[model samples]
Target: MKTSIATVCLSGTLEEKLKASAAAGFDGVEIFEPDFVASSLSPELVASTARDLGLTLDLYQPFRDFEGVGQEKLRQNLRRAAAKFDLMNRLGISTILLCSNVGTAVSADDALAVDQLGRLGDLAESYGVRVAYEALAWGRYVNDYEHAAAIVRAVDHPAIGHCLDSFHILSRGWDPAAIETIPADKIFFVQMADAPGLTMDLLSWSRHHRVFPGEGGFDLADFMGHLLRAGYDGPMSLEIFNDTFRRTDPFRTAVDAMRSLEWLQELACQALERDGREGSRMELSPLPTMVAPVGFNFVEIRADDHRLDQVRTTLHQLGFTDAGNHHSKPVELWSQGGARVIINRGDSTAGSPAVAALGFDVLDPELAAERAGRLLAPPVPRDRGAGDEQLLGVRAPDSSEIFFGRVGRGGVPAWVSEFGGSTEVTTDPLVTRVDHVNLAQSWEYFDAAVLFCTSVLALDPQPSLDVAAPTGLVRSQVMSTADGIVRLVLNLSPTGSADTAQHVAFASTDAIGAARRARERGLAFLPIGENYYEDLDSRFDLKPEFLEEIRELQLMYDRDERGEFLHFYTESLGSVFFEIVERRGGYRGYGATNAPVRLAAQHSRRPIVAAP
Candidate 1:
């Protein structure tokens, strides 16, 4: 299937959009009327530029509110349609998007709509062009796609066809199975968009919250499957109205848009295969085989060379022993059971230690790298010296590096030898492995990070939660594997302040004992006020001994129908901190109920950030 995107989905001039689309490997573009009208180039120059860039002008959109009017208004609309048809010829585009009437509808009669659309189609045929009628979700009448399809069938003109949009159909809770009822020849074009499950008005939701597929709550795979079964093989173009995309870098937005389509096609292809069908006439290419990571092999922290004492001391107090230092770089590796953390003192331009990279255990490193490359995620830059292992890596949406670690027969990573780690530990370590990592993200990269995690790392996103802060709401999204070996928490702060710290949580069989050991080492814990403990005791009616111990250690506790969770946070050293968590009896949450309290504690100690 061909891939296309509307010019309005990106930022910058029309020419820049065209170039970026081509760079991102899009086959065509829909010339959004406003973008074209706002450009200084004439129709001829625009057509020539697209031709030189090897792009087809797929559609000209969107002529609105042309039906359900009185005679004088109908005449005026036909004249307007004629002028647009002429402009389409000059631009070498055959299809024009004619959205259903919203504000200009005077009657609820389908007969009026059919007659007006037939006349418009007759004029379109005379000019050798086509009209792709779309059903806006909030249109006054003909909002239902099936209703618009019935109108198109009644019109029965050669130049008239219905444009199927996934957003409008799914958002309205319409039955997409009705799509197959319409003949393949009557479907002109297709548009794809995904949005969160919002409860606002349809028009406002469509305008402000639309996101690329896989980044939101829509079941796009099922929608695409129904379309494939309907036998309408056309361009899968993106028509997004997102506030962030419009303000972002056009080139980055275009690449992210392209990735969504690719991921969607793969999803639909898998759907077809599951139904025991080889595939449709549409040539949907399957992506590289997705293999979720087994577990975290290592995590790298970058800090200033002179500011490493606190980080080292904290790790030691948490029961991590110094494994070794990198042979070629100023990086040290520390280990506790299966968990490994790297302290890099080479680059600290940010003035604080932050998560710089992550390594995941994969069955086939090269194959995983190939899959990421196909999704347009660039490989993590490497600076290897002689006799070093061939390490493969890629960059995440927030610029963190991801390395694919290959293990030997004993499940030990082969690259650990490059850092001079000993063959075995001299003593037993306290924590077992990394449970999860909470990564703070800028608002611009939150959605992109979610999609990137889903497509590249093969992580499934769990439900999102809103953690209230004094400043505003902090949106938290967790992405992890089915068995919960690997978890990533992406936090969208209200201010997206760079000073917001990220934390690495380690798993321990006895979090209470681990907290006691760290406290014995004179480690400072993030204090939980007495008020929080008193409220916790009242809420859960916890045992007196357990309550007193937790209160003494500043450990947060949460219980549910399934199980209980015990966790504690360390005092922050710049933009980094540590956490030890114990999940008893399959507790799967991150203690979100206590997040507000934790947030308040951290905020009070943070430096006051003045208004810019």
Candidate 2:
């Protein structure tokens, strides 16, 4: 599959964008008009530079407001087209994208649009150029793919064809099945973008909120499947217009765009295979088989040498016992029932205690790492001691390591032997295994991280949610294995805040008993407002004693039709926190409704420091 991206999707000069795209393994680039207009280099120089970097000038984009006008306006538009065609000739580009007119279109009549497009086609043919007419979601007349394709067909010009954009087609709730009926030769170009579900105007959303495929709500696999079934064998280009991507590092954004394309192609291939059309004309790169993890094996925390004692105190207060010390390396293993926490005193100069790595138990560690590597996620290299078991780990976008291990293999079970073995058990503790892990990321890296989790680790991402935060709104998404294990709650921290603390939630059979034990041991619990308890009393018909117990323990509660949830958080120890949770029956959520209360309370206790 050929991949291309628009220059407007990145941040930098036109030259920089071209270099980044080539470096990220894209085959071509669509020159968005504004990028060329702002560049100091001539069109010839841009073309030559792209040639030197092994990139094709795929298409010249965005000749807007070209249809639906009187003869005088139509004549002027043709002249404008002539000028752009002359530029495209200089740049060695053939196809040009003409978006449906959203403004200054006098009529929505199909005959007028056909006539205007035919005139544009005549002008384009003079310069050996092809016109790919696209429907803008908010276009005045031809706002749908069917409408645009009908106009293209009516024009009957050899140089004019339909341009299909996934965002424009899918965002309007139009059925994509009709795409299979359009002849592939008439489908000039395909542009793709994914986006979070938003209840906003189409134009604003299209221009500001677009994301890469696999990071949003669109069923792009199905979308691409129909396009392939239509036999459109052109470059699948990216045309994202996101505010975040525009401000991020151009090289990183380019890499992420390439990754999204790879992931999308794999999904499309899988879809085709499921439909028993494995021998289709569409060719895709080979992908490793996906492996779903069973559950979290352990969580590793890295504490600054100075704060090691404080971290130890917090763990001990929560009823964890020192299970074993690492044979080599300055790491200690703390255990409470089935849950294990590895505290690594790595860098002494580090400012705070933070989550360093997560360990997951999968069926095949080697296979999982192989799949991740194929998806462009290389494993982190670690120097091993003579007896240390090798763990396959990949670094997340935020620089945290995610290690994979399997049972009855040279993985987690073998590594456990380095610690004094199962015979070293002492006293029983309150907390059980890890219920879920909460990772906080900046807005810039959020989508990339989501794609990594889904494509590399084979986790299924749930719908995203926007929760009220103390500073602003926070976006939260959960990714989990198919078997309901290895849950990861990713929090997109609001920009300009130091509230991106990492957390681990441990499951407890009796939340009240666990709370009392921690309290007696002097662990500082984040205070809850009395108003919360009052509201809980109003919401649920809990017994008076139960309400009083919740008020005394400062716990948070949420209930649904399936079950009830009770949880409480620890005061922030630098940039790390902890949660104790008790899930009654089949509660599948993370108590997102109580997030605002927790945020307000955390803000009240800690001084505000903006995130870097």
Candidate 3:
């Protein structure tokens, strides 16, 4: 099923939000109330723009304090509701979010609240709109998903339904199993937000601490499993209210959000598979005819320098053996166990080694390409043979090629069986797969790339961010495929100069350990100030040693109630730098808190010549 995110997830104005949503692999977006209120674009115009960008307005939210209120307040709210409904109709939005009363009327009894909700539901029905009633965790009363669902059922109106928010449900320590009991039809919407678990006031925490999925500690896989089991097929909108996210580059933020969602998708897929759910199995098209004997096959890196040789040497020292060379490609293979790293000495002049291409082996390359093409654009063929093409290819946004070919049957290299060696084994574990790739692009090409990934590659768009410099410089646009395997970040340079892509981040299972290992290897990293962590006790109940170590190492951090993330940046190499991240428990986002620091470092290091 197609997935959608709230447009508010993108840190920008309404127009920018729509563009970012389209780019981020989102099938649709929930239009937040604030964006609509602040937008100069008419509802019709906004709807038209959404259509032009190939986005659906999945929801129009939120009508707050709609249930349990005084006569005068009720009248005022009804009028506002009517106006919003009209606007939604103009904007071609079918779903409306009605948040349960928070402050004033939350004390009202459930009966009164249900009666009020029924009236609003009847009104919504009049306008041909469905009302998604959401329970606020901090509400005066009725602050749980089951409770909200009960109210909706009590209201007994087709137009009234419950909106399940992952944050509210999990943060309140509610049982996720309750999801199974609710009728699937009663679920009008599903809102998701990941957070690092912390001992702080929920109000302050929810407003400032939300992160993207996979970056937090919540068991979102289990939550999604429950929903899937209940047959919920609705848009899972991300509603994060992060301080750093709002301040960072919108495009990059959106890309990060999409990546987080992609990770969640993978987790969900795994969970569903474990549960033996029908239609949950992920069968790679063109099953492998010859498997590489259940061992590490290869690890690929697209780099410029002999530095890649150093990386290879490091891998060798760690226990990998040289495999073989690609006939025409600039790639060499190294392997140990079931893992392999393919080092590509392809144009690393672009600064960091971005993933230039991915080569996968399948049973039928042609059929794999065909299935992929049906989902995305047809693969761009790169190699032709005497009788037929040897492999099938697809071109990604950065002009990199993704190739699929047969590997084992007559495809295995003679060197595969001859290589044997036991290299040094360190206690430190290397990163788990190339978690994701980040690409840099000019502003103008951003949307086109997003469209290519979404329409041609069949990848979903994730959430995004809008970043502006203190000098009022704004660069934006980010997109990623669903499943978080690929990410593309676009920047509209303030000076509008064309330059090669810079900076690439690799994921690590243990950020602190990686940093320590790198430090021991004599690599210098930027330091995080002590003042940031001085208030750790007040903000989070973390252990003193852990907090002190993080502060001393200059790690940046942010968390919600479910998980925490720690990240540190390395010295800039030209325009690029590296970020090492470690997620503890439910964390799922890159540390946005570190963006300003990284950008500041970049700005400081940039050569300063007198203006001509």
Candidate number achieving the greatest lDDT relative to the actual structure: 1
Q: Which portions of model 1 miss their true places by more than 4 Å?
A: 276-279, 348-350, 421-428, 496-500, 609-612
Task: Compose the digit string of candidate 1's lDDT tens values, residues 265-349.
Answer: 8888877776534225577888999689999988988888777888999998888889888899888998888888989888767
Q: Relative to the unseen true structure, what is the Cα RMSD of model 3?
A: 11.5
lDDT by residue for model 3 over 450-521, one digit each (tens)? 544443344445555545443434344444544444444555555444232344454567777666666666
lDDT of 1 at 38: 97
- Candidate 3, lDDT over the whole model: 0.65
Models ranked on lDDT: 1, 2, 3
Better of 1 and 3 by lDDT: 1
Q: How many backbone clashes does candidate 3 have?
A: 53
Which 10 consecutive positions of candidate 3 have the poorest summed lDDT? 287-296
RMSD of 2: 2.4
Winner on TM-score between 1 and 2 is: 1
| lDDT of model 1 at position 505 | 97
Tens-place lDDT digits, model 2, residues 261-377: 989988888878765553256678857786687778789988788887888888888888887777887788888876789989867876788899998887888888887776667
